[model samples]
Target: MRIVQEFTKGFWKELPPFKLVLGLCPTLGVTTTCYAGIGMGLATTFVLVCSNILVSSLRSVIPSKVRIAAYVVIIASFVVMVEMATQAWVFPLYKGLGVFIP
Candidate 1:
């Protein structure tokens, strides 16, 4: 029963970009136009997936006290990657996304 409850909690109770409403500020800021929205969504998705994989893989090694700091560092690195990629390949998007990229 505990295992089932945990599974349901994680899988059903915590849907993203909707129920959880993570990064709401950036979502509102960058989605002014369709093209900007698409670009921001793609970048955000890439960062999220990559960051999750990396963080899960490192969870065992990361100390409990600094777990959040570690996760932030990992995610920030991916954010920087997205920023550089956009600046190099799509300067317009880099400009359009603006402060929301950070």
Candidate 2:
């Protein structure tokens, strides 16, 4: 079905940090070990999904003039929150990611 195709597309067709060619630098930079790689991948996925949901929900309410800035703010907030949570709960990963996040 079309829905399933759209959902599964990322697994291979548009696989992130590879075929898509977006944010590949961080993917390679932070992934020194398998555990670190998985942690970074999940964090990236979470931030993207959260930002998408927030932007889509606010699309109607936001003015076109500042839409880009608004999305940046939303994405930045999510990233910061994730970073703090990782720092507090998963100090090892926080350390592993090192300067890559900033």
Candidate 3:
């Protein structure tokens, strides 16, 4: 089925550091240690899911001409919140990621 193919493809066909090939900069930069990598990954996943939901919910209302800007604003807001949370609770991670999160 199409759903199975979609799930399986992520393992090899479209997996990062291989076929997918996008966003390599961040992956390489933050993956110096397992803890740093996992921390950054979870934070990123949270922001991505939140931003996706916000974007989808507002898709109908956002103007076509400024959709890109609107999406950026939505994602940026979540990023700021995540950065603040990390700084407050996980100072080491926030410091490790440094300029990457900003």
Q: After superposition, how far is residue 90 of candidate 3 from its true place, in Å?
A: 0.7
- Our model 2 lands, by Cα RMSD against the true structure, at 7.6
Candidate 1 lands at a TM-score of: 0.75
The Cα local distance difference test for each model comes to 0.89, 0.88, 0.87
Model 3, C-alpha of 8: deviation from truth (Å)? 26
Which ten-residue region of model 1 has the weakest summed lDDT?
A: 17-26
Number of the top-ranking candidate, with TM-score as the measure: 2
Q: Model 3, poorest ten-residue lDDT window?
A: 19-28
Q: After superposition, how far is residue 18 of candidate 1 from its true place, in Å?
A: 6.7
Badly placed stretches (over 4 Å) of model 1 are 1-18, 22-24
List TM-scores for all candidates, in order. Answer: 0.75, 0.78, 0.77
- lDDT digits (tens) for residues 4-66 of candidate 3: 888889777777677435655565679888888888888888888999999999999999999
Candidate 2 whole-model C-alpha lDDT, 0 to 1: 0.88
Please give, for residues 1-102, the per-residue lDDT of candidate 1 as tens digits.
999999888877875645646565566677889999899889988999999999999999999999999999999999999999999999999999988886
Q: For candidate 2, what is the TM-score?
A: 0.78
Model 3 deviation from the true structure expressed as Cα RMSD, one decimal place: 6.7
Higher-lDDT candidate among 2 and 3? 2
